[model samples]
Target: MISGRRQKKLGVRTLDIAKRLLDYGFHPPTIYFPLNVEECMMIEPTETESKETLDEFIEAMIQIAKEAEENPEIVQEAPHTTVVKRLDETKAARKPVLRYRKREAQKQ
Candidate 1:
């Protein structure tokens, strides 16, 4: 297990990533993501030095960040995962839909 300043340095990376993602239109990759309390963006690169796994995951994460910066289409298309994805969530968020299409018009 990585201890001391290294771990602390790594720990702050979550925030760093979030702040960096701000440049893009989307929010910081969902701050404390997943809603599982501590089960968030706590990637322990120090814990794993398997080279391939580390390189691959880190590289992908980097590419995701870059993609977020350059073309957000990739980030938005993060598919084949769970229920929260693969749909136009914005459409579901329309309050008119929530209120059964009761638009504020013609009502006296």
Candidate 2:
């Protein structure tokens, strides 16, 4: 288990990295948990995982770090390849749109 803390100077949050992981064909790590640590990302790799898989994840992480430094905006607006794009999490949680409302016919 490896827990990484975000570097605020890098101008990227763990959530951004988590979303970006989808584009790299990986699931996002646990972020901002444990309460004590700020912007913590917890990664737990099982022994069942092969060396190649671990290497790929390492490479992906390195690449993401580089992207975070060079192109923070891209990292900030992530999950470009996912089925659904980034959402307003606060809005979704606060003002959820549960049902769809159809428009009535307008008068000509």
Candidate 3:
């Protein structure tokens, strides 16, 4: 349970960290809920994960912290190695393109 406020000035956003985690082949933890804490990240390792796996996750988090300090932009724009890039959530919600239509269909 690590809250991101400790390094907020460095532009360390919880969403950015979560996105970066995807690059390391791990799912992002639940973030920014339970309003008592700001930019909260709850990482609960289940019994299914071995010790080595937990260690790997810790190492990845450390690396991400370093990257955030040295190259903040990288952390800000995460998921660089993924197939699809980030999306504008507000825009998507406001103007959603749910289905596709051919040009001929529109003309008819």
Candidate 4:
């Protein structure tokens, strides 16, 4: 349960996060909006990096998964490895920023 202000703050934080994701060489993961549901974040390093990079990514993912399972808080505190920080995900969705142009603009 959060207010619009808190949600906006989280949204800004998430936006900052999404920006860094762009540097990953792959697009950022899809973010839902105006709908309220738990979000899923994913990263398939193969989509963006070389074999060596992907291997490093896989290793990190494996380690992260293990740590997250061992202590869920670790993952919750993740995105830390990233430029972004953990946030109330629900807030992220209620408000979002679109990377692509507006649908109407695209159709024009």
The estimated TM-scores of all candidates read 0.37, 0.81, 0.84, 0.40
lDDT of 4: 0.45
Q: Best-fitting candidate, measured by lDDT?
A: 3
Pairs that collide, model 4: none
Task: Write model 3 residue lDDT over 1-108, tens digit each, in one string.
Answer: 788775467987988999999999899999987678888999989999999999999999999988989998888898888998988879989999798668996888
Indicate the residue-level lDDT of 49 in model 2. 88
Question: Which is superior by lDDT, 1 or 4?
Answer: 1
| Candidate 1 regions with alpha-carbon error over 4 angstroms | 1-40, 45-49, 80-108
Give the alpha carbon lDDT tens digit for every residue of 1-106 in model 1.
1111221233433444444333332233444454554424644445646888666655656765565556655454554233344445467566435335555795
| TM-score (C-alpha) between model 2 and the true structure | 0.81
The Cα local distance difference test for each model comes to 0.46, 0.83, 0.88, 0.45
Ranking by lDDT: 3, 2, 1, 4
Cα lDDT, model 1, residue 18: 41
- Clash-forming residue pairs, model 3: none
Q: What is the alpha-carbon RMSD of candidate 1 to the true structure? A: 12.7
